[model samples]
Target: MSASRDTRSQDIIDRVEAAGLRIPAWQAVCSVLETLGEVLPYGTAAYLASSLPDSMGAEVGRHFPADSSASQVDRGDFVAAVARRCGCGVEEAERAVHAVTDAIAATVPFGVMVNVEHVTPEPLLDLITR
Candidate 1:
């Protein structure tokens, strides 16, 4: 990775770790991105990935197929997916989701996040918002 991307990724990891979720910050962030890959439209995911640090962007792109349509993932299922990916329990997964989303919100533009909120499901809205 480029120096800038590596620095940005570390910044994000530090923010997520500050949330005290116990799981590794990079793992938590990747798990959340993978779970969101199931919910966000491909275009949305692409836009989001573009805004992220290189490695995190690739994580989203890896999980979300360019041609695959997005799903309206239920909150329970979303948490479960994250939990499975992070090898953590439901509560920890939920915290990670919130922390990762907060990190994403900090990195991306406000308009992009507005678009993300528009496509995201109501049940899981709180997880994505600050």
Candidate 2:
């Protein structure tokens, strides 16, 4: 990877760290989403990855349409899925995802965030904002 790309990835991580989550837990949240992406339609995973740096987008995304009939998981289920991936309880996972999403949201304008909301379901937005 180019130095600029590395810097960009570190920039995202540095921002997440500033939001008060450690790298490992943030990584867990990301890993969980990447796995969830495999089972979901590409759109949700793609949009969710938009707030991230390119390498991270790659890290948390891979196969899509793994379940041909699958769609985006709702918020609670999304939390549960992430929890399972991180080997943590659901509530704990909620905190982790919440923190990371909040941090990412902080980097974008409110208008962009609203656009994100348009593509994202209400429940999922609640998960991030609440």
Candidate 3:
């Protein structure tokens, strides 16, 4: 990644930590991106990633669908997956999710996040928005 992009990626981790996720900031940010891979539609994932800093955008794009498909997951499943990835409980996972998503919201363009909102389910929708 370019120097500026690397700096921006670090900034995202910093924001996540500032938002109170207890885990290492990079891990928390990565966990949230992986969870998004499970939940988001292919096009939406690609679009979302495009708006991120280079490292994060590439990380998220790793799951971008060749087949234009995504795994079926609800809010509970999303949190559970994040918990598993982070080796934490549901509540901590939620905090990580919130912290990372908040960071993403602040970092990415508003329109990109709105696309994510439109594709996300109801209870899970609250996670990104909150």
Candidate 4:
């Protein structure tokens, strides 16, 4: 990877780690999504964070139609395309993609919490930005 790409990936890893959500597995996922956000024209990172699986799957399918039948290839290509678009090295994009895929796999079972009354969005967003 190039120095800049390495630096950007590390910066994202460090920021996410600092957020107290640093499960070794999830860190990789967040990194990829961050990179995707950096690369893709559309807001994939935000969509992944907020959308349901079916919606995200459809979006992913629509934007990256590699082989109508083989979704994994499309997903991989999408990540690579996003990385290329974002100006990141291929290795960096691959790492980010793997990390994100792993993170999503792990988080799916836990489900999401919607108790806005208890959660503070600012601190979480601040943590991510910082």
Candidate 5:
């Protein structure tokens, strides 16, 4: 890996570890992102990370806030909303949801790290392998 990627990876690993999530869990999250990034556009992984919910839920209703006027919807709601705004069909929206959920499952234990640079796959995998 390039020096920059190595540095970025280390930074992500440190941030995740500092948030107290288990290494294995973080690894799993990174693995999913890496796979998704390969299949999607360059920024898709970052976009997914930005849209994840703060907690887990079986459905959008369960995770979204009770108030419709809230600035921050549940992470799940935010992602689904984004998909709708993008004009994606049901299956595409579901895929986006899954990508966001997978990311959240990886990071919640650690804490939310919003820095896209930190989680990009080249750096993320380097961090994981080390």
Candidate 6:
């Protein structure tokens, strides 16, 4: 892998550990972040991007607040996006979402989670709430 890839991987691992999960959770969480970054409105995406490290900022930067409101995707579409991004089955993708978000809920500050939740759409509540 290139040095940049290695650095990005390391940054992700550090973040996963900081979230009280091991490195294994990185892909799922990254998928969620990318999907949100792709689909959220500019203000909402910026809210989430601000919480992430600089290394990760670029992954979502391109689509973060895409030109049209049509860029927004629904909850089922989000799950499918994660599945397609991870090359996993929908069930597994859903499980990963639940696991990753649950870890975030456990480790991230409550206020930050609330801020994120405020930016998230209603159909996706189960990703964090359940």
> Who wins the TM-score comparison?
1
Who wins the lDDT comparison?
1
| Model 5 worst lDDT window (10 residues) | 54-63
Off by over 4 Å in 4: 1-67, 71-79, 110-130
* Worst 10-residue lDDT window, candidate 6: 15-24
lDDT of 3: 0.80
Question: Which stretches of candidate 5 lie above 4 Å from their native place?
Answer: 31-130
**lDDT, candidates in the order shown:** 0.85, 0.60, 0.80, 0.39, 0.38, 0.63
Model 1 score (lDDT): 0.85
Candidate 1, residues 15-117, lDDT tens digits: the string is 8989998899989999999778768888888898898987888887885574443344678988998999999999999999999998888877888889999
Question: Which is superior by lDDT, 1 or 5?
Answer: 1
Error of 6 at 104 (Å): 3.4
Candidate 4 lDDT, 61-86, residue by residue in tens: 34432223221224445556646543
Q: Note each model's CA RMSD in angstroms.
A: 1.7, 3.7, 2.0, 13.9, 15.3, 5.4
What are the runs in model 1 whose C-alpha is more than 4 Å off? 66-71
TM-score, candidate 4, is: 0.33
Q: Write one digit per residue (lDDT tens) for candidate 5, span 16-74.
A: 44544322333433433433333333343334434443111112223222223222224
How far is 119's C-alpha from truth in model 2 (Å)?
Answer: 2.3
| Candidate 2 residue 129 C-alpha distance from true site, Å | 2.5
List the candidates' TM-scores in order: 0.91, 0.66, 0.89, 0.33, 0.28, 0.67
Of the two candidates 3 and 5, the one with more favorable TM-score, higher being better, is 3
Off by over 4 Å in 3: 66-72
Worst 10 residues of 3 by lDDT: 64-73
21: Cα error in model 1, Å: 1.1
Q: Give the TM-score of candidate 6.
A: 0.67
